[model samples]
Target: MHVPHHPAFPKAPRLPAASLPLALAIPLLLTACGQKPGEAGHGMMMPPTEVSIVTVTPKEVPIEFEYVGQIAGSREVEVRSRVSGLIEKRLFTEGNRIKAGQALYQIDPAPFAAQLAAAEADEAMAKARLAQAERDLTRLKPLIEAKATSQKEADDATSAVDIAKAALKAAEARRTAAKLDMDHAVVTAPMDGVIGKTLKEQGSLVSAQGDSLLATMAQTNPAHVQFGVAEAEQGRVQQELASGELKLADKGFNVKVLLSNGSVYRETGHLDFSDYKADPATGTYAARASLANPDGKLAPGQFVRVLLMGASRPAALVVPQRSVLEGPTGKYVYVVGKGKDGNPAAEPRPVVVGDWVRLDGEVKNGWVIKQGLKAGDQVIVDGVARIFMPGTPVKPVAAGAQSAPPAPAAKS
Candidate 1:
């Protein structure tokens, strides 16, 4: 047959069949070497990947404010003596609860007793003198009327009676003063509370103005907490109050105290009062809360944190703190939104945050998303650091997607 101008049927003699196989293999190997790592030997391209992602959910979020404060007794007083004397005995045991008007200490009764006794004696003598004066006056009045003696003599007798009456009045005044001095010998508690350390022991001399204090008494039932709020944040607090963001009942706000070890106090307190003017030194306002201390867990000068949670926001959504990530500039999260194809797509959205609102945080500013995120979207909380990337495709695996299932226990 006649051959056309093709290389396969060239006029030159054909190579061996082995050489032909080799020539074909060389082009095939070259093609494999020239291809990208991901592309197959046939020049097929790899498709975009699909990654697993989480979405942010939106719900009513009730906002609250937390502050650091101090625990104090609602009614705290230092027990001291009204008059100067030696402390004879301390009646109430230290660190024990006492009642109002309870006698706490007894001064030396000897001095006070002697003074009262002397006053009584003086009072008795004054009465005797007054009796004699009355009798003399009675006699003088009749003498003056009858002129039995000279009018001048009767007048002198009346004057003498008046002088005796004046002497009795003077003696009676001394007795009253002595009795008052005696009553001050026994010191009593002004109010009901728990007694604290005793500064003066038996035989210790205490004066009315003595630097030495007898002891301290603190009301344990309703304790007080002193807290400070920054001056700049006044506007936010005012708005919350005026707008009823914080709903105080007929009483006031319900307060919770947090200790340094993160334990909640047993009792709830109420917001008692606020300072009229800002503190000149701190540039913050002082606030006081009355806390119940039935167990006496809190005391004055103890530092703690305060939470105001009187209102109820049942519609609010609470999320675990681990779901959110923080940055130096602000806070942000990766939310999975549905693409046109109904596939989940992750997008980075920034948010403004307010005071931490319990389990979930406050979104002071709203978050914007163009993808499939919705109110009830699911978020990947566990595998966050591994696969969170914006506009990137990934072969995503849920936190424990491939873990082997636990084998069933051996049949009994």
Candidate 2:
């Protein structure tokens, strides 16, 4: 049959199947021969990883504990009025340091003054009556003795004198009470302290029965720093105390105050009070330290840190904090050990760590090694993440050195 010449069919002629296989094999042979000597078919061998190591050192580390605390006044009292009256004027500036008996507020004294005046008038009347009764008695007594007056008259005069004396005494007592009330109208500070804002302003009615709080005052010098100690720590401290490992003054342990900004207070403090019982809610015991704050730098209710000092460990194994690693079994550190062919390898050593020693403002310097480490052992401080196995080969270098790069290829 006559068929139309299609463009796709008239394109080209195919080669022999045997020759096709030979052509593909030629390219494969060239690729295989082009490979460099001693090279792997897939990937190249990686050089040993470089790591930093630190030799373990035993030190006499000072044992200290830090706890959050708050500053408070050594003595704090609420200023209140003793009598019911209207506040006439503010007598002291807010937040000003004051001495004991310093006037803080003035209540209206007009009513109290009038009451005192009435009491004085009554006392004067009583005195006049007493004088008259005494004169009558004197005259009646002589008259009765001389038979000029009856015995009943002399007895009545004596009774009148006694009544007059009682009246005078009562009037004088009232007068004293009135004077006290007048003096109380002027509110004064109970102790030397810094006064807070006045709660009741001028023209406000105040009373003694309700204990109207006029203001608050606090003695902040020698400030009281209040803190809480965990129950576990408290027990440990007691145990150490009994063992004579820690020595404390008669008052208590000496402490250092660290402000929130990481500055140490100029003055040292002494622990004065500790609760006998632990708080059930927080499992802590309330404690207080008295710190000298003559400049009033520490104020009431200021948050701070308290560092318990004056204790230490004679021999403590420590390592750079960076060497510590957390694993399934707990904390561990990579220690350099001899491997096959005398090559160095990383071996994991389990460790128990205590509190950290800070360098500058909370920066970690090293860790207190409680267990699983000894002096002179080398610990991997850097490049720990690259270690996949316990016996992985590593090139040890001094801590803080930069890892050298891979060597260049050898010249042909």
Give candidate 2 regions above 4 Å deviation: 1-59, 141-151, 239-251, 327-329, 340-346, 358-364, 375-412
The Cα error of candidate 2 at residue 68, in Å, is 2.0
Clashing pairs in 2: none
Best by TM-score: 2
lDDT of each: 0.68, 0.84
True-structure RMSD for candidate 1 = 13.3
Query: Using Cα atoms with residue i matched to residue i, what is each candidate's TM-score against the true structure?
Result: 0.70, 0.74
**Per-residue alpha-carbon lDDT of candidate 1 for residues 1-412, written as tens digits (9 for 90 to 100):** 4534422111336779879988677667667688544445643543334434343454444444689998878888888787778888889888888999999889887887898798889878878877887787787787678877787777777777788778778888888777776877888888988999898999999878756478988886788888998987777667765875444455557888989898888877778798989999999999998877877788678899998765433333333445556655455555555545455555455544444455423333322232323465554444455432453333344433654455888799
Error of 2 at 212 (Å): 1.9
Which 10 consecutive residues of model 1 have the lowest summed lDDT? 363-372
Q: What is the alpha-carbon lDDT of model 2 when measured against the actual structure?
A: 0.84
Name the weakest run of 10 consecutive residues (lDDT summed) in model 2.
Answer: 3-12
